[model samples]
Target: MVDLPGFKTFGAASMSDSHLAEVTGVSSNPGQLRGRLYLPPSLQRGAPLVVALHGCTQTAAGYDRGTGWSTLAEREGFALLLPEQARGNNPNGCFNWFTPGDIARCGGEAESIAAMVEAVVAEHSLDRARVFVTGLSAGGAMTAVMLATYPELFAGGAIIGGLPYGRASGVPEALAAMRAPSGNATELAQAVRSASAGYRGSWPSVSVWHGAADHTVAVANMDATTAQWLGVHGLDPAACSTEHGAGWTHRTWRGADGRIAVEERRIAGMGHGVPIDPSGSDRLGVAGPFMLDVALSSTAEIARSWGLVAAAEVRREPAEAPVRRRLVPEVMPANDTAAPPASAATSGVGQVIEDALRAAGLMR
Candidate 1:
């Protein structure tokens, strides 16, 4: 419960028990940036942390409200940090993943985001071993950049409806790649492989979720991302399939080190929106129970398998209640406690008895 200076809480009932704070500050270069922090009501000394980044045309609040991730964090006892993009950073409020300096190993938006993570971790009780990063669309691209540049900082990442990596070329090339039609799947796949090859450490485990019908980011990006991870990790691409669910398919690539696990989830008939229900106006798709269930389920599975979450705890049941009429200890005979079987009765005898009783009582 460390008091964050200049941070304020939002009194929404869904997160009333959590500590919410918004902070605006200058980074190392004294450049201004804004971010939001969601701390659960009861956190361990060093709780796991999740850094959630928003997509285009979305702010921290909009992202939090749209995804309902804050509520999940509150209930699950994890801290959430959201780094916002100011209009000055990108005209459309998107992180400049296309900018040359921004795409580099330690420069531009990548550096600022890394700074933000460092700031929050320094001020909070974050477990260094259990930090995760996730984002959508442009935010997802930025997430890829973070994974590439700051591989040591995050345990893993989830990229939803995003590209494989950001380009260090010019914005025009980046924009062309961003707006490229869905047909050029091969070239896009090559680009992702090239981008990910630059990472220095053991590749981080990654989970990608894409809609089969997503037009904005294009569903083909999932194929490209999967190919990139597989190629880099020397996995056989032919082994992938769409048989996981009726409207869902997945591919997993394992690296030689056995620590890197890359997977893709392709949802049938889905769009560029976060696949959730009861969604806010800012969300991309219809919000419903399914979206949260899917996201949380995926997250939990990853955490549980990766040792990010603790193992299941066992509990003992209460003993049976004492018998209403206890026999005297000296006179009682030992007998099995199991229930006794009743003698077989004539078929329809109960019905006949009930009919007779009803007739005698003049009732049906």
Candidate 2:
């Protein structure tokens, strides 16, 4: 593995660490990664499971603490799987999202995580159909890898400040792509298609979150990632209905059946980090570096989107149906047609800046 000098994880120390148990008996860990788990005291049979990946320089425990995922899992009664990276694998403690072997199907880090998920489900009798994944920064990119390589395993996924799958294969390419992501919708969709070997199974729904003012990873990646999934689902890019909320722009695209297949949220004036509500009765996640207090909780919003939160716990007015425009008419053989859905921090230049800082005795 190529080591990028001075690349460090900048997640601030969390207030309190969550209780996480190490997972054992995982079959064939080719990635040689560590696994941590959080199971509620009272887990129902066939409960849901969520696999969360941590960004570079962050640990499973630290991620759980900062994101409040474990706390939410305990309340929602779902199991949590957190895959940790060893220093030997990547000096910066980042998942090798850009590496070919690590992200490949049935191999390397991807397979190790898959095996961990399999073991957890079998041991806890968790529901396989409801499995979901989400990550931030490098972890977010890895989330795309999982969805592309193991499409059948996840019902849905959320990517926060991440890149699309198959965007880079080496360190140099990764850095360039991070600074300026390149790929038309068709090209991006083809990359996923090539990775999965033309698997025709039902595709997982996608949720994308990004910061408009993020200097680490450019916001253009959000648009690219969205286009990639839109092409994958065969949805019209122009059919989206946008909602303007306070400090954010929410956009949604629906499938033929009218279910939301893709959703994007761009937080105004926010930097590269997961948005959280630090002071609220319904708050989730602690505010820290890369964990900003944007008065909006991505953790809660994601859980609600995935139906993990109880209806009573969510206090919101009913949403009027999104206004969608079908620009193209579908005439499928005059019969029937159906469609399905769908970085990290500073990649590239982020590494350059870190290196300069370290060289100048500005950063350790």
Candidate 3:
């Protein structure tokens, strides 16, 4: 039972309401790892779970605040788990995705994260089969690590502004590849396919999001990553093409493997930030549109395509009726004129959860 430094907890009763809390003693790695849990309006057993990972220099709260995932979770009736990186474990407060030891099975960051997931599931009523993971930058890198190492555990993953891990060729090469700019789509694709082979079950569907102008991660990497998945699934890499939007450009790859599918999104004119919040704070670096939207939509699509959710059931209900509760007061900003500082730096996870709950009308 690891105790966090300044943990807090709060909740509301409406089915559309959300609960905020600084969960401590949740990570098995005491003193080294801790996480913040965002419970949505409904916690009936078997609810979906989405584990949101943060980038370097970003806390769990900061990530939640910057991205507004808790709000989405509340509206969609899912649990959002934000795991914190202890300073002792990661000096920059970033997950050690580049380190071979960290990426290995049941050790380093992987073990700590897996333990956190287990703890959350054991303590809460999370639907084990519907579990998903997504992240940005370094966090995105970690998300890729989880998919490769624990393919059996995750239903799907969304990688934004990040790249795949270098193969067992060696740590130096892997680290270099991880840090290198995105280019050579063929190599990137090969790496993903090779790494994914280690998984015990069917490969999980993946959605990759990258920015065209992302100087940090490089836009080329997106193509390479997508090609790799296409190759592995026996799909034509050349078949993938680009789609332009007013402010974004999306690249997609669609293929079927029994129940799983693969897809990707590349945002144009975007930097190394989440896609949805174009003007997001510098703490997590530059962001484009909300990546959460992409994540949720992709998740929902995969659920339906893979039969995790019945298409008829989701389509039968009207959006208005499904919104059982609304917490309008909680969402209105204290001052509409002033922009809140990016929540990733000064605020705690509790504050992010609160904002999400309020934004979704799940809190008062």
Q: What is the C-alpha RMSD of each candidate to the true structure, in Å?
A: 21.5, 11.8, 11.5
Candidate 3 residue-wise lDDT, 77-129, digit = tens: 77888877776665546676666777766667776777778777777867788
| TM-score leader | 2
Q: What is the lDDT of residue 25 in candidate 2?
A: 82
Off by over 4 Å in 1: 1-19, 23-32, 179-199, 239-242, 256-260, 277-364
- Model 1 has an lDDT value of 0.58
Candidate 1 residue pairs in backbone clash: 276-287, 276-288, 277-287, 277-288, 278-287, 278-288, 279-287
Per-candidate TM-score against the hidden true structure: 0.67, 0.83, 0.66
- The 10-residue segment of model 3 with minimum total lDDT is 323-332
Q: What lDDT does model 2 reach?
A: 0.77
Best by lDDT: 2
lDDT of 2 by residue, 175-218 (tens): 66676788899999988888886789888889999988776677
Residue 118 shift from truth in candidate 1, angstroms: 1.6
Model 2 lDDT at residue 299: 84
Instruction: State how far residue 297 of model 3 sits from its true place (Å).
Output: 10
Going through the candidates in the order shown, the clash numbers are: 7, 4, 16
